[model samples]
Target chain A: MSEFKQAEHKLLLIPGPIEFSDPVLLANATPGTAHTSPAFIPVFGESIKLLRKVLLSTEESGSQPILIAGSGTLGWDAVGVNLVERGDEVVVLNTGYFGDSFAECLEIYGAKVNQVKAEVGNIPTDDAIIQALASKPKIITITHVDTSTGVLSPAQHISSLVKKHSPETLIVLDAVCSVASEEIKFDEWGLDVIISATQKGLGVPPGLSVVLASKRAVEASENRKTPQQGYYISWKKWIPIMKNYEAGKPSYFATPPVQLIYALHTALESITAKPISERIDAHKAASKYVKDELTALGLDFVPKSRDIAANGMTAVRFPSGLKAPDVLPKLAERDIVVAAGLHKAIVTEYFRIGHMGVTAVDRQRGDLEKVINGIKEVLGKK
Target chain B: MSEFKQAEHKLLLIPGPIEFSDPVLLANATPGTAHTSPAFIPVFGESIKLLRKVLLSTEESGSQPILIAGSGTLGWDAVGVNLVERGDEVVVLNTGYFGDSFAECLEIYGAKVNQVKAEVGNIPTDDAIIQALASKPKIITITHVDTSTGVLSPAQHISSLVKKHSPETLIVLDAVCSVASEEIKFDEWGLDVIISATQKGLGVPPGLSVVLASKRAVEASENRKTPQQGYYISWKKWIPIMKNYEAGKPSYFATPPVQLIYALHTALESITAKPISERIDAHKAASKYVKDELTALGLDFVPKSRDIAANGMTAVRFPSGLKAPDVLPKLAERDIVVAAGLHKAIVTEYFRIGHMGVTAVDRQRGDLEKVINGIKEVLGKK
Candidate 1:
């Protein structure tokens, strides 16, 4: 759109650091702009407002968004350090590798973690979640879409169950892989917190950790009984900074990534220009096409059922005799890049393809088609 | 160099997020590149090696560099959680605001911090440091250049005193404001750790936290008595990831910031193209010119003397009957930007001007000349 063209490169069909738009990249190429400059203040403020719209949150909903310079994993630290005090009980609905890691992160901060782990290709059952809630854990974490196995947990249903069974327990959704591609109704779903990053569905580079906390979640962090165990990840230092920026004033706790923030501002402008539902619908349509094509190719999926599959990406088990080396290298030779399996349980049996952001919403790119055809050619099923 | 031109904006003369080169910005504009991709592995590996050269470290010196997606503040978390166990005795050589914040960060992780305080715009006395070393603290932290007051401590002299008085104490330097613009001999100066960020003298955007640790410092982190109090900031998870990238292998604990790494790679390539001392010398020359011009205008400096002042930036106190409101806005009117004071003790008495990276090294840009001329015009001294 800006008359700038990126150099030719392999199609990055992996989960994240997804293909960004030219305008977004151009914004990222911004010259030195002070974080507190008059020109950058509105950019930061507008980004905060746009994030609320993307999450289906509102001013009256009393939800606050925090943008920090870190990866999605740092979101785990933000939650672990800010909301959970030492010896507090936390329930983790484990779907795949991310669930185990999230639980591990919480445990590192001295949480007494209770995990409801599903099988390799499945989501935890409702019965297991309800059982875990009986203990009345202080917080319950759900990986909305785990990147490892492409397992999509039902966020709304889980939040409903938590509201009915343990209304006081804070609901934190790890939406790293699901945010823009999947339909999320934050306030309607009674969600308290959603942790995400820029590289996935946000259509920006990987440098920002975006988290939204409900009013109650903020109050909980403010009411912590002990001194914060970590400094950089503490909410106390960041809340004022966010409040100031959103108020169109310049403030600094730690330096914000100015260029990355510019990229995010441009990406968000494009994303929110149309109705967000339309974008989500486009992702849904793309997901179905890719899944249907893969199924027709006689491939099996990591998610046990189509309903539990992530719309942003898909994990397909290789044919019995084929492995990653047998298929991945061949695809690479064709200038297509996909990821090997990440779940430790089935690391060698499957591979993954991501269809999010421009890859999913911008059909003109034909990225999904390229991935499907590449897979077919590699498997000798063309 | 890449034929990419950034839009013109106000000259950023703040402490950091200084002016970046076009090539570095173009690199930041890179399209999607997977963190584990072979194409990205070498970029990351070379950035690590280049960081060593900038810091005067080497593989033979057993110094390892850790690059993470966070601000310079995150570096404190990495050191605090990894090296200081519960109730560990630590001494902070306080120069200004940064020293206080560093001590607070360490205390959050259960360190007992003893700060050797100095007056505003002054470094701690040798007697005070020697007396603090009598306690034989586990670590002694120094602020090489405190951005708040533009006070530069004598890093080599402090490390020498620590080595002579408390040989077991780990010497840490907070070089966030002085990594490339100032000389730091990591091995020869007996420094165990040097904490920095990308935006300062590295000429990249402010997203990546770069910290270099000597072998003994790495060992100290490895031998922590207590479990890590933080998860994302843990060295245990990051050491292997850094090592793998440096070894040209792909590994992941959390996703690295792919585009920022590309920018850092380009910036480091340029920074290490010549002897690092040349870059330091350029910063020195620029600093002297700015200081002399300000002095000719009858301005007082925040630093007590030129010998202890930082080469990357200068803090100048307002003459009687003048303040930031009287000068900063006028500079802004001329499209020249400088920062108001950050040190609380002199918040209304002074302002800061940065001369680092491209702004200091690329004289052809005439950035310094413009800043000097703008200041003279604003003060009606032209």
Candidate 2:
């Protein structure tokens, strides 16, 4: 119906919805298709299966239902709104900004939050978490990677602790930033609910959020999350539609974003084409290269230890006297965009460079080097 | 990262995501620019301005608040989640499917629903409505077009009636199928909230639902609707972001579908290129032609009067004992796809043809003729 135009910009090295390639971007401009079309159901059906496969789960053993929506963070509302009875006791693990945000969101929903916090860039110990669960947290919510502190909580380790101590507490891991960057292992990690997004490690544009739900999550949803259900986050209707649609009676609660799904379908194919090991390794390599360059620049790190830093992002403390406001605008003048820390505590102190969705080894290195040099120049260390 | 793939079908002409021209589809695929990029914010800003313009609202009197998410139906959720409080009275005029859906959805949000009934294909008179709203209602919800019945209600008339009878009640119109197909004056009609989506009149893909908010809608939203708010549907965070994103600070409640917006921006240009009046007239003329052809083929109009029929779609009733299912697959084999009647009473009695989007003019006319001739050929009608 119209001509699509491209904006003139150099690149986005920001965490999530990072610089997707031109061809990938063009995927969204495809002609809209009817969501219930015979051709669409299979493609959509296969996508949920592939998403499970990528998350290292299966329909039977994993039993985590998958739903595609417009935002990744919606997964939090889905989990918190469902499985959360009014005044349900939910233990929130305050690892960093996202964890706090999740707790605040749950509090809004009338959940009593018992926080088990760790130092901003450190992981909480299994014992510390077990002690917190003494209050009987109905839901144990944790972030896989906190965007602000660049901390990757050992979700697998925490899930193990919750299983042993609070056997009944449902576990929800916010994998919004980590799913594509590293191994989520939904089944292997015994994750009850895993929330992810297309933009982050998946390398697709922002819009679609993926939820991997266990049978427990669904069952819990039925008993705990009922009445006055928020329309935007209902997995109940979507589940039946997805089930019926694949079996041949396709329908929707609302109009499916056909073109974005086209792009996401393409993005999914790319992820599923290669083995998960290869994809994770590529992100690992990309992260290593960016970290090395920054280390060589003599900058301080935000995380207390390198092991705690997120694979998807490397957060480095800005030069002692320099703030992100000053450094970021200078970076922007050159058309290179990086992420400002989300937490008010470190928003002025640190900046993040994301390395997800890289097309080639060389391109990742090139973008990292450009960022490295820009940082150096800004700090007068070049 | 890998070769991109298009949707499986060779033809995607059902309805919604009608047919994105090549360049428009590709626009969404562009790399993730900083949402607050000097280059990007203006583009985002322009989209809001363009929407306000097309929806026929004054810029000063209106605020271009953008909320990015899935489907037009979410607009209803946004309005309810943000505006309709528990025990508040919401009047829903049910001319067709979405009107019923609006009533049902509002009821879910704890609103006391006053569902004003109308004949399946007839608009409820403004007088009937004003009498119905003798007691002040919190909101007046109506639909411009009923996609299920091919009926266009007198939406403007209802808005004026609400203004006269209950000035305090907000006027919320579901213009999902009528915004671009027909005229939807968001401001002039005193409509507080007008919801349309990408697929139908907008001439884009089916992923995003765009809603326009008048000053009153925003004012009403300031009142808390629910004890708990769904984050995805929360306008508190979204409205402020929309008002400020142009200043290079991008704060969105949910991760917006980036590519979808890009394609929409492109499609919007095409829709507004020709004056909207011409587009509206063309659809009206085309719909009349289809109706005439069906009448010539000895079929009755689904809606009693031509004036009641929607310009975007034409629903034609089949002869007695003629099932739509029997003729649909046969027509599909001949390369035309039409919608089956949604109401159970009309399921076997009627079928509908969509004439919106980039449907070739003669092909559309010929398609109607083919459907009519094909039905005649199949039923052994002389």
Candidate 3:
């Protein structure tokens, strides 16, 4: 019924599980590997190697850098549960929705959450951060691209500010949406931990979240006092497992998401071989074009400024009388997919255009045009 | 050069992430529905609907079940931490190794584990449990099949035994390996909980652990007074999330592993549509062929009794001097993969022949022949 003829039509334009290529899907179909297989260590190592490269994490910590399973939200729990003790003060920059969620999750783990406020388009300025730094936060957390509101805070500026004012406060960045879509210079940004998932940008299916810890973060993890975070998500137990198991010893964790790892392996090869800059540019081009087309069709963007809008997502606010909820299904009938807004801030008024993954690059022009035309046909442009 | 053709071969023969079909892989490639989409609730509904059929749970209790992400081991902790409060006395039947490991995980949550010991090839006699239940224990847990020994316990007999003697004592069965391969009658057996994974007989990749619960188990979960188990592995949160999200209100604890659900939806459909008895026959026949070919090559099965051996895995033990580790590489060289032993009781003496998925069904004759010939070629047998 659709132009996608691979027996897998259902183009996913919503952020993740983006239309994966057949080769990547084939890779995902590869058999499960014994965690202790001597041969599997390199595959795990190579995947981690590429993960680090894609995230631009060049730091050499004493142990393995990444943990394979669990979600992006749990990365905050992992960091909070492992790095922060009962009374530690944690600073969370709540530029948009996910930041507040991150703070609340940390608070549940018994850490005191200190929030710095900014709405969708606005970001925490250097002066605002300089004041928060005075309290001596144990670890500072920020979201580079708030997936909820399509806000892209300047990563370089935030990193520089943290390095200058709060030198001791280990900065952990939620780059779950940013990693594959935008440039993430982990080492350059001085981020102690960078969290990402396979779904976004990597063009693999969702299941695994890749967490990169700087040397300091791992050291902080060692000193964690609480009864260790549940074992499955525990990084402490897994690092030695990766080292010994990859080298053909007994595995610590049970069988990982094997097929998903294979898919991630194939997807990483595509991203790493080509410079990340090109991929980011592709996402930028796609997002910009979608914005342009939507603008011409008389829809407005939710973000206050184009410069601050997330490169991966173009959040559009529909006209006063027209609801995105009504228009979404009409497009779905034609096999065109887009994301609806998540929270109270923008649900009925907004819909999102995700410019991530291979399809966002390969078929962006036709897909964008179809979406634009589909919208106009449904609700005649004013 | 290695004989595994990266182009034509590397078919998955390992237990979980058991070889998936292209149709199912494309299912994952289907763009995602909004986690809260009206269509998605039914898709979620359809997934749970089919699980009830596959598990053969009580129709009334089947309507509300717990579906979670992450590894199968999480199921152990979920059952342990939730059902078990500190100082609760529980009896575990250790027919093979993983039952003891489940006991160990239960211990982490402060449940006192009194073990009822049984050998690998043997099932725990009713007397071992009868004596344990003499004092009215809190719960009785048993492994349905120990993948390590390629052996199963008489769960049907034991669950009924618990019901007759100690109806107050709850029954939990770790059906991780036996869920789809064997006829697991959750309702008839009166099991409080039945836990299994996506990989085994589910005809999909490994990433999910699907659990079916009884009303008593649900009631027990409600009265638990613990200050909540760790956040990441909380089944309490997931049970509600599944209902609320599927009922059209999406709550995010952690992002659902979207692709695994897609694979699961297709896999569960094939499982429920075909009668469980027919699926059991396929597994039994496939296992029989594997064992038959192994015997033709002059080998012995670790599980001496055919009645108790696992249909999914035929645990074959090599002769006195010939070790399993030596012959694994030979079969691996042929691009015909099999598993090495899981427990110390059989590690050096035995290797496993996994006949779990469609590959095991489709390529059984050729795959078994390759394994048989490879073993003969490696061991220099006639």
Candidate 4:
């Protein structure tokens, strides 16, 4: 790698802004390269191409990737403004905090939201989803892996249901926590939009809002009945910009985060170095190991079952009489940083551990072991 | 610093994404750090405090700084969605391309934008601005420095005019190309909002959108007649997040770009290390030197007069018979990168050279000399 090593830091076992590889960080430290420079255009273009391979979508499939400088939340804005016109009915398959927030975001743009909310540790029932579709909502949003509870929704199943019940309803999978760590067959699943960010399973630092839209999604956005409500997150403004960059030409609606794009290029390069299925398998192994170990330590989980849990991360409940302050600080003292619970219903009862990116794929890092052992030691002391 | 050296690359002399210091890039190479970790909270909090110093604003003045992950364009969204209600009258003091785009952004959020048009490479006249204010528009937006033509509008004068004629009108300064390189006395100038990004004069990479809002502006946003038109860019959603972080507590509406915040922390540390006035003077000196040398070489400028030209960048017209294609490629051959014109009316006649941050302040780098000499050689060859 060029003999460059990042400075020592805490082990970030949080769901996102996960442990990035040295090559990725080195790319992030790239010198000031113009966004439109020959050196950067290919990086931007290649990132777009690699995102398709990661999502299992393709250019021939008429899928477009819109990459912008913002968090995953901005993807919600993209959907609200571009896909949903004022007062259009939108179904939000709510699993956790993200689902609640996504529904709120859509409503902010004047969507009449129909929420299908699940219990604290469960996915929404298929019947509930079908009932929501009865209204023929213009869009249905599914949080593929909600970060708050580590719950994995049945995206493919949901997409199939949307197709069978309401073929016109766009299927938007909020894959912010799922993309690289989970197996997503975009075209095969008949998915319309998969909204994501770089910091999670993609293994780059945050600052990029990545949304992959199918042909139908693009058409829906373009043929919106009303003028776009927002300016920055408007797909109309970004479509040409993405098209131009993918064509190896430099164009600007707003300036791209050039350094982050470099980091993403390096990250996507490593991520797609081999078959993506292998990476997904690695995450599965890591997740199982962490969850199994935590279960043995007498901790419960936020997800109702193993099958419903995300492979990229796990949300675990503390033992009896234990809360966030009781466990999180102890782990921090051991140089491991994880996130506290975010679901308001069970906010104080659980915590999250992320096993994506290098943590899952690069076993030599010993990140999972350190976290597991740290938790075990903390529990023993308790 | 820390024995970390960035890889050698081409000299980027464009208006922004300017050459950053080694320290800033090294901070960008930081390993995974959670956005809410103890280590990052202070870095974020300190960056917020330092932003006030750079802008000559005060917490006591009740001004709030909202930092989010996006380009400078996102700052426009923040203004449009938060402050302007549907049918609200807004005045745009048009200077160049950025002014036109900001007007477009405001209009997207339902503002009736009355743009006081200026000729190419010129600022709007006082009489035109006064006439526009006769409607007592809700907001008056000024582009402090239009990157497209290197034209710097008289922000203070416009603020004075607005204050005298329409005291209730909010003064918004689009200082994307001017923030760190130009002196902005937010409190003294009666500015309601100063929209900027990190790349240009802050000496950080592009990703973070930084906007400082006056108390009145925040009130106007909170007391909006209608619901906010956006979700992600909504000031209502971000104000508490900023306040919580500034108060040394972690709160999240959206995930912040962690590594970029680290880079910004380091960049701001350096920018505020000395009196901000010195940094502004350095940019002015560099701009003058480049302008003097270009004038000596018989080159004309895009801005009508030297007084109204931007201190962070120079837009120079090619000598007659020589266009961007004739001179820019030759400079590129010497590994010096400059930007082609962005203002559509004069897009083919001129190109821009940036001399901000390290290029302007760190004389030992000889970056400006390299670019000036490269241009001179290209002209000599022609």
Error of 2 at B275 (Å): 3.5
- DockQ of predictions, in order shown: 0.87, 0.52, 0.36, 0.90
DockQ of 3: 0.36
The residue-by-residue lDDT of candidate 4 on A157-218, one tens digit each, is 88888999999999999999999999899999999999999999999999999999999999
Model 1 misplaced regions, further than 4 Å: none
User: Which 10-residue window in model 2 chain B sums to the lowest lDDT?
Assistant: B1-10
Weakest 10 consecutive residues, lDDT, candidate 3 chain A? A1-10
lDDT of 2: 0.73
| Candidate 1 lDDT tens digits, B152-221 | 8999998889999999999999999999999999999989989999998999999999999999999999
lDDT of every model, 2 decimals: 0.93, 0.73, 0.73, 0.92
Quality class of the docking in candidate 3, CAPRI style: acceptable
Query: TM-score for each prediction?
Result: 0.99, 0.92, 0.89, 0.99
Native-referenced DockQ of model 4:
0.90
lDDT measured at residue B71 in model 4 versus the true structure, 0 to 100: 97
**Docking quality tier of model 4:** high
Model 4 lDDT per residue over B1-382, tens place = 5888889888999999899888899999889988888888999998999999999999999999999999999999999989988999999988889988999999998999999989988988889999999999999999999999899998888899999999999999999999999879999999999999999999899999999999999999888778888899888889999999999999899999988999999999888889999999999999999999999999999999999999999999999998888888888999999999999988999999998899998878999889889988999943
Number of the predicted model whose DockQ against the real structure is largest: 4
lDDT score for candidate 4 against the true structure: 0.92
TM-score of 4: 0.99
